[model samples]
Target: METREKILKAAAEMIADDVTATISVRAVAARAGVSTGSLRFHFPTQRALQDEVLRRIYQHFMPNDPLRDRSLPARDRLVNCLRQMLAPAGVGEDARRAFKAAFAAFIAPDPSEQVHTAYLSYERASAGRITHWLNALDDEGAVPQRDRAKDVRFLLTVLNGLAMERALPYGDSVLQSETDTLYTAVDAILGTAAS
Candidate 1:
């Protein structure tokens, strides 16, 4: 493989293995079997390298994401897209395990700078993806031109709460409640809330 591709691959592998998603330049260079200078030649800064890796990761995972489906109503599409984020949590024992892993990685104790930075990077990427979806809806005139930042925050807050609920004993109505909450949030953000 070429030098640039090799470096990127090594970095991506490191991120995949790391619970905090931390990427160290020297570590990547060592893994790629290249010198730091060579790695620097392709990616001038750490942030640039991280951004490129995240962009590629998102593209690979979301190539045919539901958010791109124009056939569905805007609200439905948005709600479905949000639901996809929670699908990995499953339910019952699965959800509990997922929550346990997350807590151990991010919430059990004080997080290091690397852990904190990695968390922030992921958070920013998620917010960026949500904003992109909102922008697409706005372009289609399906959503109002409001403060999209606030809307993104609102949706993320709801998603976080719903994810936590999945791990708890919510009884048989959990799925229906989640769906209703998503639809209501989508409606509010799109300015189509029922009277």
Candidate 2:
């Protein structure tokens, strides 16, 4: 592979192995079998490197995004995209394990700077992705324009709640409830009646 691709692959591997998703220049360089100067040439600052890594991670998670499909109703498309965020958490034991790992890494005790930075990076990337979807809908006149930041925050909050719900004990109606909640949130943000 080329030098830059090698560095990115090494960094991505480190992030995948790390609970906190933190990467240091020296560590990444060592993993890539490159010098610190070479890594820095590709990504001058740590923030720049982290941002690019997170962007790639987000793209990997959201390949073939539903937001690009205009054939579906706007509300359904938005809710479907939001549902994708919760899909990884699974249900029952899988969801519990995911939450447990997250707590151990980020919440059991006070998080260190590395953990905090990693969490914020993920959060920002998620919000940015949602905002991009909302923007696209707005551009197509499928959704009304409003306070986009507020709308994004609201949608994310709903998503987070729904993700947590997956870890909780619930009956067969749980899936229906989740779908209803997502539809309600999207309709509210779009200033339309719930479908």
Candidate 1 residue-wise lDDT, 21-136, digit = tens: 56778888999999999989999888567656765666787897786788878888999989988888888789899889888877886989867876787687677667767766
Please give the CA lDDT of all the candidate structures: 0.83, 0.83
Q: What would the TM-score be for candidate 2 when compared with the true structure?
A: 0.68
Backbone N/Cα/C clashes per model: 0, 0
| lDDT digits (tens) for residues 1-195 of candidate 2 | 999889889988987786355679999999999999999999999856765776576578767888767788888899888988888999889999988887788788677887888788778667867876786677689778688889989988998888889889999898999999999999998877654
Q: Among all windows of ten consecutive residues in candidate 2, which has the lowest summed lDDT?
A: 50-59
The residue ranges of model 1 lying beyond 4 angstroms of the native Cα positions read 1-60
